[model samples]
Target: MLIGDVARRSGVSARMLRHYDALGLVRPTGRSHAGYREYSSKDIQRIFHIESLRSLGLSLREVRRALEDPSFTPAELVADLIRQTRERIAAETELLTRLRRIDAVEPSGWEDVFQIVALLQALGSKSAGKRQSAALSSVDDVPLPVEALVEAALSESDPNVAGALRWALAQSGEESLALLAEGLGSPAAEVRARAVQSIAEMPNDGATTLLREALTTPDLVVRRHAALALGVRGVADAVPTLIDMVVEGTNDVDAADALSALATRPASAKRIATKLADRLAEDGVEPPARRRLTQALADIPGPTASKALTDLSHDEDREVALTATYILGLRAAR
Candidate 1:
């Protein structure tokens, strides 16, 4: 077959066939009597082989080596091609995400687009100062996309930068709540904690609702953050987890403070006192934990708290009884 016929049948363009021939990649094996390049059956098979290899992302040079070099091994080359393809896909995906974020900004002009891109790049910068500055400036003239803020908040390791990111996200209002909630489900404990912390800063009812839901998560850290946030919002449902935080001695001080805040409400004071007293009475409650629980009761008012302290005042442990006596004395002095 002539070059034209091969091009027609194989779907390879005439120009590309000539380029292949010029590169000595798929030269025809014979010449027609009319002094034209002609392809033998073996040459046609070689062209198909070249096309097949090219489809797998092989460069022309690699294709030639694959077809002609006896020492060439395809295993390593194939693995390299797989790696390159994966890299290309990742690059494309990142570019697409960037474009989507830019579009989400609803830029009014090219200058606005440039500014948004600059801020986004800064958010991902290696310098913590740059990231924090970017986060602080994000709520400027053009607000950064909430998604970008959430992503930064979840991954940030620097405490200051993370706080700025969380602040920026909170400014975005309830829209940031969904992404932050999704972060709560992340397998990384740090990410989940960040999500809960960020949610805690959002004062909207949506955030409060999500925090209430987070109270039941399997992660103890997540639950503690949620409970503290909820307790501050006067959500009585958080009382149990806040009490648990005290018992486990995880952020127990903050937990106690939250409980005291919740106890200010008349209806919650007795219930909070009862839970604390029960934990105090549990078998093997330990001396230190008992002391901590006893101290926790000092802030709670109402007869429930007063009577519990009165009962603890006569307890067997000297420190416990003394601590309770000191608290009751302070209450009496009031």
Candidate 2:
């Protein structure tokens, strides 16, 4: 086969085939009597091999080494190609996401497009200051995409930046609640925690509903965080989880505060006191945990809480007795 025939059949262009020959990658193994470069069957097969390697992201130099160097091992080269291809894919995927966000901004013209682009870049910047600035101003001028704010809030590692992003999401809209709720289902525990925290900051009824649902999720961290928030919202469903937080000693102070907040109504105060006394009565309730529970029960105003505390005032644990005695005295003074 001649160069043109090889180019036509193998899909390699004639110019490329000549370039390959010049590089000595694949020279025609036979020549016609008229002095033309004529390709033998083996030469055409080599051209196919070159194209095949190129498709796998091999540079021409690498392809030359792969085809001619007997000492070359393919394992390392193949692994390198895989790494490079993955990097290229990640870059392209990031670019595509940026483009989609920009389009979603519904830019009126070049200026709006530039503004969205700048904000996106800042949100993704390496500096925490830049990310926080972007988050703070995210609601400026053009209403920023809520999805962008949600993404930043879920992935942010810096506490200040995370707070700003959560604030941005809160200001963004009700749509943000759905996105943050989806983040709760993420496989990563940190993302789920962030999701619940962000949701906790949203004051809408939808956020409260989501928190009630989150109380049943398997992630204990998420459940605890959601429980704390729901307690502040006066959702009675958070009572069990809040009580658990007290016993577990994780954010027990905040948990106690939430419990106290929920105890505002006389009926709720009695019910909450009953639950605390029950947890305190459990067989395995240790002294320290029992102390925390007794302390948490002290803030309730009704007869049930006072009765529970009066009983605790004579408890076996000296510290529990001291705490109960001190709290009971305060209640008397009031």
Q: Report the number of the highest-TM-score candidate.
A: 1
What would the C-alpha RMSD of candidate 2 be, to one decimal place?
A: 2.8
Give the clashing residue pairs of candidate 2, or none.
Answer: none
Q: Model 1 segments beyond 4 Å from truth?
A: none
The superposed Cα distance between candidate 2 and the true structure at residue 25, in angstroms, equals 3.6
- TM agreement with the true structure for every prediction: 0.97, 0.86
In order, candidate lDDTs are: 0.92, 0.91
Candidate 2: which stretches are off by over 4 Å? 29-36, 313-334
225 in model 2: Cα distance from truth in Å? 0.9
Evaluate model 2: give its TM-score: 0.86
Give lDDT for model 2. 0.91
**93-182 per-residue lDDT for model 2 (tens digits):** 998988888888888899988888888888899999999999998888875678888988889999999999988888866888888889
